[model samples]
Target: MLWGCFSSAGTGKLVRIEGKMDGAKYREIIEENLMQSAKDLRLGRRFIFQQDNDPKHTARATKEWFGLKNVNVLKWPSQSPDLNPIENLWQDLKIAVHRRSPSNLTELHLFCQEEWTNLSISRCAKLVETYPKRLAAFNGKPGDLIVINRLAYHHWAIYIGENEVVHLDPEGGDSSSSLELLSFRGEVKRQKLTDLVANDSYQVKNLLDQRYRARDHYVIVKEASSMVGRQLSYNDDTYNSQHFARDLRYGEAESRQVRRAACPAWAGLAAARAATNDFSDRRLLYRSLKRLSK
Candidate 1:
């Protein structure tokens, strides 16, 4: 879900959250979502001004529908100042979500929006002074900086609040990195080790994904067991039935020999990098930054 920022501080209060959403909806759909979130703010009778850069749809299919007389579409900076506080606010809000599970998705969305309203503007201003940290991160190891960040538990936060920017999102949503798992899993060291294991669950996941790819290339077929062979089946058809592929017969006895070697989490990370076929140092850095920008 996406939400818009509106500030009553005249023209200065702007909502600056950056996130990615999929698919395209009609302009009315976009406006309706924003309107609903606006209502969620409980702003009462105050006239909170809202502005946005020209979204593609504004000039396309739903242009007329969205050209409301009161709505203002402001011009945007090619590269805006790091002084904007909402940037840091977004980081902290994400951190909260990454650290704890909300009651549900509705609660999660409301919590983030509430955090934004409650964030201290003064703290976000302080982060503006640290803008050099970002420039330096880019200048010194523009390449390595992203790698260090990407490999972090999730990702680092640059928290923006009423005044200070709290760095957030140290890791990510998947097994490769789990900020939530690390925060609540167990002792830091033991949890780190457990997270590093990439358990049977993870292996089977990879196998299933690989099976689909193979099928696309005509390397596999669709029978219960045709996933890896022309005719195959397993006692547990539940997982296979859902994925429409054969389950890993770990009992195949061949799986037991799987180089079951593992080291400390940090060392394991290094080994993972070396053993992984797709972990290109530069390519990964490029991809990581691109992902953040989006």
Candidate 2:
């Protein structure tokens, strides 16, 4: 067996594993090669170490080794195949080493090392550059609520899988300026999550799941997908980004931001009752009452 890693910086140390591999031997390989590889690749402090959830990789000793080194290991998803860019390099290395036709173990090791080094830095960078799309690919199951934090406020969407989301994009499409998101007319649009997120940070946040039961995943996805390309006049008090996502996930449209800004403190319980009773269509009436009471 063999072990290796790569980054936008370049390929890391490649080690040939002998005999049956276990936790101790796996830790030994990482201890011997990981730090040196990081230094050689010029990856400064704060680089996240990613590895599969193999039994040996997640063993107690391995966890201790990382803790001792203060390495920030990425929490890999269970049952998910490793999608690190190094997988692509492995394929290329196999083809190149095969052409040499090594006859012995010693020759095979030598050819593997040579081919690993021959992998181009540009190719490594391109892989890393396009990695985000793949990173978001399995983040959420279908119909899961996803949130993008745009500094001032959060943009909400429902994951329909394949790195795409069902979201309400402003009529002119998303704007680079965060302020523009405060108020705008929008339409339900199916867009790539990466394209919608741009440089902003996002995560799968199935918020309020404890308070409100999530609808059937297939039903949520089907209903949300059906709204694609439908126009919506943006109204924080009635229907907004968060409301749309919540409606799909929970069969109720409730925006905490809108309630806090537009509703009175005395009306909190009443507002909750309204949401539970499916009085969403009467939100405009409630908003007018809030204004009058204030």
Candidate 3:
């Protein structure tokens, strides 16, 4: 097997593994070849390391090495080969090598080196650039909840798939608009997937199934869409995007009792209470504990 790393600027060193590679062996190769390549390419501390979830790659020793070196490893999902650019590079290399019609192992190795060298920097950069789009596509399933934390506040949106999301916007006008027509703080609007996630870090909450009993996704989406352009008071406690999401999923009324300051955290707690059919404020703490214990 062959192991390599590349960046938008250029390809890194390619190391050929002749036999079985354990965690230690893999670490050695990374330390020797990969680290040297990074240094040679002047990557400095700006690059993020990407690796699959192979046992050897995720071994405790390997993780400790990264921590000691202060290396930032990209969090990758398991069994997601489509998101790994290196996999595509390997396929391209294989195709290039086969075209050479190498007759022996030495010739095959030579062909691989030549093919790896021939991979253009622009092509490598293009592959790297696809990372975001791949990630967006992976999480762009219908009815998926996308949450963005903007330090002092949090925002919520429902992914409609097809690179679009339907979200309640406080500043949205009373009309339907495309994703491109809406801003982060705009009124309830449908916007492209990219606009929602521009530069902020987001998470696929996927909490619908957990918070409420499974329902037809189409039904949930339809309900979410019906709320588009519908005006609701924007109170952090009673009516906000989180409340909007809960109402769409659970069909429950927002809690009006203002026992504390309104915030997304409080909204979430209220939603959790509603999920368990516990809407009363009487002995709230005990009731919540009992429901949780059950």
Q: Write the per-residue lDDT of candidate 1 for residues 1-294, one digit (tens) a residue.
A: 444453322112223333543224435445555545445544444333323233543454444544552443434333232223334445666766666678887777666666656555455455444434543432211101111212322121111111121111112112233222112111101111112221111111223233232222112211211222222121111111112222122222222223122123334353344344333222233334455587
TM-scores of the candidates in the order shown: 0.29, 0.48, 0.47
Residue-level lDDT of model 3, residues 1-294, one tens digit each, is: 888889887788998896779998999898888778888768897679988788998999999999888889988775442346666677678779999999998998889988998999888888788777766655545676777665335677777655567877665533233322111232577776556555445677755465456446788788777767666545433456765665555555322222233454555575455355333222233334556687
Clashing pairs in 3: 169-187, 169-188, 171-187, 172-186, 172-187, 179-191, 179-192
In Å, residue 211's CA in model 3 sits off its true spot by: 26
If the candidates were sorted by their lDDT against the true structure, best first, what order would they fall in?
Answer: 2, 3, 1
Q: If ranked by TM-score, best first, what sequence of candidates would result?
A: 2, 3, 1
Residue 284's lDDT within candidate 2 is 31
Per-model CA lDDT versus the true structure: 0.32, 0.74, 0.66
Give the runs in model 3 whose Cα sits over 4 Å from its true position: 78-82, 140-294
Candidate No. with top lDDT: 2
